[model samples]
Target: MDDQPSLARRGPRHSTNLVGRSSEWLESCAFNDAPAPLHIWGVQEMNQGLFGMLDQAADLAEAGEAFHAYMMAMFGIDDEQRDVPSAGRQRFRSSFLRLIQGWSFDSNGPAGAVLKGWVESRFGVCPSFHKEIIDAVPGPAWEVYTEEKMSSQFHNNAIWVQLDLLFEFCQWAIRRFAFPGQSHLTLYRGINDVERHLIVERTDRREAVIRLNNLVSFSSDREVADCFGDRILTARVPLCKILFFPGLLPSHLLRGEREYLAVGGEFRVSVDYV
Candidate 1:
């Protein structure tokens, strides 16, 4: 067995009220007293099915339970029949409790770093960039759609699952990060091609928007800007912004989409593929 601290060891419990906090804040508070190996093997074991639970969660309490189940899955805890002995199971359960209680908005701390790295390793997009895109949106009327939920025709066979998991992580990261009075995320599945384009166009016209594609591996804002050539134009929408994945040829465009996809006055806009 590993010599690291067993899940039985007690640590500071996370608070239930996490509405205003960032992901970084949550991680710092939760793992403040915990030792190394915050990157456990079980976290990778989480699949898309388990992640979908977040969307279906009815309330914070239900969300908390779903989040706990996610962590338990990560910890390799068997939900069926309690594979471990009673004492061990209790320790695992206690540890999972601490884990979920610690969950909050902000992803800049040690735990956040672990999660970010995990996301990057698994999904191929930078978590920080993803967070920035989310933050750039206007009044939080945005919704997250997973590939599993999207139409089969729209799914990218190569990266559909990864995209779904990426959005899942994004949803998990931004749970309580929304501003007060902001609306909850609408879960979208079975969106058609036209609907996807309209969603992008609507978001761009109304508020700031950022759409991420698998074609690009984003590390910094500079890379995002460079993806577009000298054709950068001033955005009509005040704060609206869109990011296209790299490697897409300038000629490639989504059907019913404008030539330019980027939408911020301050930042250069790129029009490539959605």
Candidate 2:
């Protein structure tokens, strides 16, 4: 068995029953001493499903039970039927406890260097970032995994999912930040970490409000109308870049009628899609 992380290029090996699960290896890596391993962000569906269980729940504690089923399917955390180590059997317990506790990655410090580099490559921009809130940046890392493993649609809905996740995560974080006004943002799927968001607002056309992005309700409707040629420029996310973040995003893309997650800026605005 490989005891260390491989650095050299290796071809895909045939499946084996004995290969150690990364979850176990990750735990063995001894990073557990850090903050709780955070829950998956951009899981609007999971949150929705959990909400559905609230009424069925016997009490407040049992409300989110159904949500665990998805987690099991996605992460295989509860697959005890396989003949594996006793430590593996205890996997579910540890993972379960970790879930309720909440986790985080130290992005600004040395530990998050890998993640920062990964994000930069994915988005072609170094994030104006902080260490503690790496999870808040929202990437589609397991979107494809979620769909294939669970047969759910998540790709098309990624923009909103990440946006909503970050918006909500920032609520409880109590961190001070300046978003620096971005117009275009690139998204990435984090294979081992949260995907990245490239906020592209500081462009040459910063003054020309040709598009009033729904992502940001920057100006009043009248002002936006006055700036653009068409009175109502519909704003939408950039689509070509969707395929940029590989993995689960492109594999299990979201489908019909469930396009957006409703990011309201409480300002009347227009949009321009590329």
Candidate 3:
């Protein structure tokens, strides 16, 4: 068997209290260690039925369909019909597809908050930034962050289950494509300002420990990333931390930048101001 240090050796229940606190992320989560050895991100005990279908799929397309079907079941939607109450009681559609779409349209909006909140809950990592900067110490910014998360999730009851399955699907894909013993993906993000981010430590003039938002967008292609801003931040992202990536779903659902949604924690990154 492969001897990679599987981070899923033990299952830790989602930490409710630790959500959205960047200052406590490195100390609270097990991800502060070396990134290369981690295979699963603390999810070994997830219900086998929740994502086992992915393991049996013939290809990525089949896996995507299987996940879509699973998502529909969570919302009580099927080809024939869906229960009104089970469908969620709100203006926004509670479907996982819509959530990702909403985030793509505006990462500073309600959908983005919900996605970040979910990562905080499941991974014990904190959202380093939301509509505004966030920290471990509660303040007005924390209040705003909490409010957005609550309001969005209130409309999409039980939607977290869909996200849970999504993460499982992503991990399965990572495992499939992580061939020849490679365990990390080099990702880049273009931003307008570097100071707006939470820099935990400066290892050198170009490298530092960055506390990324609980859910952040990154691109595999450097040119795609450069289109976003004048500054670029690049890092070697651990496979276990990626929640969603291009081609993981239908191209229509995930467009622009060949984006990947990365779950946050403290990570060493190189910054470039161009």
Candidate 4:
């Protein structure tokens, strides 16, 4: 916890870190990724001496910077280290390998990357909807699912983020049609970090993940059902995993949002969603 700038780098056994196989993995799989909020800073810092891209939201070099930053950050590197130049063939390949390894990009990376890729190709924007989401959506209407503010191992002490699938879709629809009305993508709260991540409910095999902070919260199970027309928590088990926590969870948790915050930690009752 004392080390902010310095990060723990695990030189997993050579078998655990397969550079060549990893490259093959990334090369074969479909890539869909967005810049996590923390990654944005990393990319900007790294791309400083590189591209003079002016646009914050649209430029390709900026997008590449953001992507590379995310790749570096996944390797447990500090944000500043994210931009180390990879001009050489070996260095570029190694750096890229680190990302493949972090993603466990064996056959497929995590769902977040796949989904973000979809958002990118379809909407032409990254999913780090920091301001864009709040701007387009009205606060009082629908549900507002905001991320929790957290400092932990997996998430690397970064603030949390959520994706309201339905709301995001609504936002997409509005933008695609150039509709001048508003966004159904409001904010939602409830279910602390653990519960938010406990269920691996699938939208599909490709988009099976729904972020805890990004979904609407009902005071009870009935509420969860009535609001989203689906069940996130059982009516009787209103607070299930949300209230209880663990230390070092399943390896699957190592991927996507679950990995963002180290999964294994003692329980600390959560009171707020950022």
Best by TM-score: 3
Cα displacement (angstroms), candidate 2, residue 110, comes to 9.0
Cα lDDT of model 4 by residue, 1-274, tens digit: 0001100111111122111222111111111121111111133344353233222425333433443454345444444333333345432322322332333332122322332232222223222222123222324211221221111222332211111121222222233332334321112223322232423234432233332211112232233323332222221111111211111111122222221211011111223222
Top candidate on lDDT is 3
Report how far residue 189 has shifted in candidate 2, in Å: 29
Model 3 lDDT per residue over 1-274, tens place: 0001112112122444322333344332335444433233434356566467767887887777776676676576443222122235435446566677777778877878788777766656556566665543377766787788777444555767667767767877777743325567788888776665556678899888766665678888888788887877788777767778877864455546678887765567888976
Each prediction's whole-model lDDT (CA): 0.27, 0.24, 0.63, 0.24
Pairwise TM-score winner, candidates 1 and 3 = 3
How are the candidates ranked when ordered by TM-score, highest leading?
3, 1, 2, 4
- Please list all clashing residue pairs in model 3, or write none if there are none: none
Give per-residue CA lDDT, model 1, range 1-274, as digits (tens).
0001101111122232112222232223122222112221233355657656666866544654565465445555445312222354343322311211111222222222333333333323322122222222222311221211232322223222333333344334334322223322111111112222112223353232222221111112332333333212122221101122111211122211222221111111223331
Worst 10 residues of 2 by lDDT: 1-10
**How far does residue 75 in candidate 2 sit from its true spot (Å)?**
3.6
Better of 1 and 3 by lDDT: 3
- Predicted candidate 2 versus true structure: per-residue lDDT over 1-274, tens digit per residue: 0001111121112132111222222211122112122223444455665345433545322322333354445444444412222353242322321211111212122222323232222222222233222222333432321222222121222322332333332221211121223222222111111012221232232111121111111111333233323222233222211111111111111211112211111111133321
